[model samples]
Target chain A: MRKLKRYGPPILLISPSLFLIGLFVYVLIFSSAQTSMTDIYTNPQFAGTRPHTFVWFTNFIDLLKDGDFQHSLKNLLLYTLVFITGAMFFGFLWAWLLDKRARFEGVFRSVFLFPMAVSSVAAGVVWRWLLNSNVGDRATGLNRLFQMVGLDFLENKWTNNISFGIVAVAIPAIWQMSGYIMALFLAGFRGIPTELREAARVDGANEFKLYRYVIFPQLSPVALSALIILGHMSLKVFDLIMAITGAKFYPTKVPAVDMYNLMTEGNFANAAAVGIILLLVVLVLIVPYLIHTARGDKR
Target chain B: MAVDTSITQRSGDTGRIVGKRFDWGRPVRFIILLFFLIVVLIPVYVLLVTSFKGIGDAQAVRAWDLPQVWTLENWKSAWQGTPGLPAVAPALARTALMVVPAAIISSFLGSMNGFVLARWRFPYSNIVFTLLLFGMFIPYQAVMVPLYRLVLSMQTTLHLGVGIPSLIVLHVIYGIPITTLIFRNYYESVPQELIEASRVDGAGMLRTYAWVVLPISIPSFVVVLIWQFTSAWNDYLFAVYFGGNAASQAPVTVTLNTIAQGSMLANYGAAMAGALLASLPTLIVYIFLGKYFVGGLMSGSVKG
Candidate 1:
């Protein structure tokens, strides 16, 4: 009652976030949980769990038989490995290079980060064309160039092979995401004071020894953060996979595509099961981090 | 700390010269930047070149090479299409319809959230904030099937004079976690003295946030707006799931994507143009606002 007026605008302003979260995410989560058990059709008779039934593990069981699902799972796992590794390595290398006060830093930074700004679908589609088997009479793109140079082993349909198609998609994801990793690496790099490097030099430390000893430890926090973020990103990846390979073409399926198919095919419970599986994967990574952060907060 | 002692000593000047301090002529640094430039520029150059080539020419040669003839015909066809753009207009309109409102609303909401959290210790605030973060990590695919069912359950009543508030609601849900993180970390840096002073002067929470918290948050606001704006514009799954049959209300991202993937002869060139156009606005905004984009993200990372 003393000065009660302080809460009004904040309350009004904050209402949207809370309200929206309640309506969309949380409510959807609840609905998702409900849908997994219930008959969720628009029809009244299908309102309860009877139509879909509380088919506990049947959905999970059926998924094993889905060629597309298994294919997508393997593809997603492979794509993630390639993307996480590629982005981290190249991103760190570039961050190291650029941290050196290059004259064209701005231009280079923009070029690298440009893909990050681009919608994934747009970038993916273009890459698909460039990698197209028919790009300028078969194998004319990089393939023809490589063939002319006698590196003909690289000429096959890179995007069509089941195993390598994942890598093809991974390239664009790496291209787009490496910059983000670079930024993280830069932040971590800068956080290490110049004095620390000077100290390393003073100890007669070589660059390799210096980084292997001094710089690497300090970079752990940022590296951890980057890896975790990228891990989740690899898990949640949709637009790139969706866009690059047309979702269904040439063994290009990923879990996201699987989820979409499961739902569209009137397999809601299985889709929900898939959704829950994905949620579990993400939660496994995030929940630990959340607990860490929450503990930090409590401290 | 161990390296610090070695590197700063007088005899260590040699070591410093080798690794610590950078001293280089402009040309050398510029030469090094070329590799970085090439790596990043290659695909974009390919995209731009292919976007301008005729369909046959595009498919005829190395898609990465310079075009023999630079024609706007691809752009024209991409825009107009062979059968024409009768299908595009609604999708484009729908995209604009969804993204613009969402951009303004989510950014504004995110800002307000940051302000409120920064200024008050509202009951259950922390718990509520944590709940919102749940959305970000929940794979959309996982929640989506149910979400689709949820939406499908009410697909019709949404437009029966109810308006599409629900769509905005959906975007805001996703936008909150990141936005909240951005603004909250940003406001932590603000001198709390002003907020305290306002409170002492009998200013309420709303007044304090409005007069003190909000104006100072413009940079963070812009950061989240630009980020959320782009993300909302490109949202596909929700739009398709919720508004599939409602083609006239489809966002450009969905429409263009569907068209590009459609069996209509796979006009890769035209579809690529649409993809490029769809991505252009986000790219433009990011380039201009890039400093804040990086700044906001880096700062948020450190704090989060």
Candidate 2:
């Protein structure tokens, strides 16, 4: 009786969350894995039913050979590379500038961070206009602004360029997210002991040298965490690109968007395959970081 | 450039300058910051300016120009909707109904889980915590198929059309990891002596939590509430899938998307106004409660 009483409350408290996560996250992931191995497609005869046979890696093989999938993977690679680097660079720069005790710090911080609150879909709508590629006398958005300032050379087709148009899509994402990275980097900067800075300075380290050697080294962990967070988010990006380029646009089509398109078309098995592949890629980026943080907590 | 270098050298020498020193870095930094400030606000400028313009004036070719005729017609059309599209006002109400309950329930459940994990340690709790944390990183696409099927089955079996209720449950479930992480980290800082002192008075675990830990959790609660509220309100993927196709059932995000991309596309002013209306709720929350929002974000991302 005492043992039951001792354990019951804590067990009861945690069971609902554990049960829900287990069912929704783990079991559903396993179900998706099962579905990925099947051959389910739309047939008018089986409109409401999901009838299938075990295809055993055929879906994965077909996806590997598919042209659209290949293009999507390429687009994802470029988008992820540009998004991570751009957000990190601007984030760190803004944090560094604000760290110098500038006037109107509160106002500047609010202006930078407010984007984090807006929905990506809303932000994407406005950005689509801003990145308009129309030129000559018909220019608009940044193109028009550039032409007005006599920097006509700076304007080009933003999300219309087939090869690198996805990079333009990353701009709105970076704008919405860089402020978050700034907050993270600022917290990291503040966490460093002041005595460490004073010690580096007393040893004759200048501002540039101090950041290059002492301060930058301490922020590596923050950078790593930021990279992992940004990397996984970039992998699952859907709404922003969807809102900007719509689903039919090929240049910005990513795996997540592809999965949605496939699902809507009743290509359930292929959608499952795409989803499982996305999950695997996210796990590859996230598992080591999770283990690292867990072990750190224990220590 | 020469003056900038001299000021840097002067500041670098002592690391503590006098009040009268003319620092060139100040203007340089201000210019750099102001430049980025303009870059960030350009889209916002376009959003506000276009929302107030007539349809012809809101075209992409003339997006930078001030409206030849500023009017409230777009806001009216967006609010009341057009011939084929539905109004946004009902969707906004549906979103409120969905977000408020989802945020409150998830936060309270997270507090319970956090209290147990943080103070009432059982075996393998760390493993449980790690497993829970992994859920936060997985793409929702991975589970989207099965989740849809599950909800479908429940609707058929229970004879209940799972609409907004399904979305609320999904948000609360997916919200667990982050909310738990935030609350656990918050509660860990609640000195152990408080729990011990309450325990010495013969209170059980639940009583101690109800009386002692619950009172001090207001700050974390605020943080989690604002975070969950914003995320749930901003969600589009799940809202599109689980939220029914009827205009009355969908959230503002989905409705706004349909309005912008539907036949209303010809009316750029209405599309822009719809976008602003969709963004207004969370923007207001952010403008008011930004500090707690940032705190929640940092605690979730930057492990203790």
Using lDDT as the measure, which candidate wins?
2
Highest-TM-score candidate: 2
The TM-scores of chain A alone, one per candidate, are 0.87, 0.96
Best-fitting candidate, measured by DockQ? Answer: 2
- Tens-digit lDDT track for model 1 on B120-144? 7576667776776676667777678
Candidate 1 stretches greater than 4 Å from native: A1-16, A37-52, A65-67, A134-137, A148-150, B1-32, B55-59, B84-90, B153-155, B158-166, B243-247, B263-266, B299-303
lDDT of 1 by residue, A35-113 (tens): 6654343333234534445655565666768776788788888988999999999889778777766666787877877
**DockQ of predicted candidate 1:** 0.52
Residue-wise C-alpha lDDT for candidate 2, range B79-180, written one tens digit per residue: 998788878888888899999999999999899999988998777888888788778999999998777778877778866455577888889999999999
lDDT of 2 by residue, A1-299 (tens): 97778778898889999999999999999999988888876643124454568889999999979998999999999999999999999999998787766678787888998898999878877887777767777777788899888898999999999989999999999998899899889878877776677677678777678778878899999999889879988998999987887887998899999988888887888888999999989988888888888788878
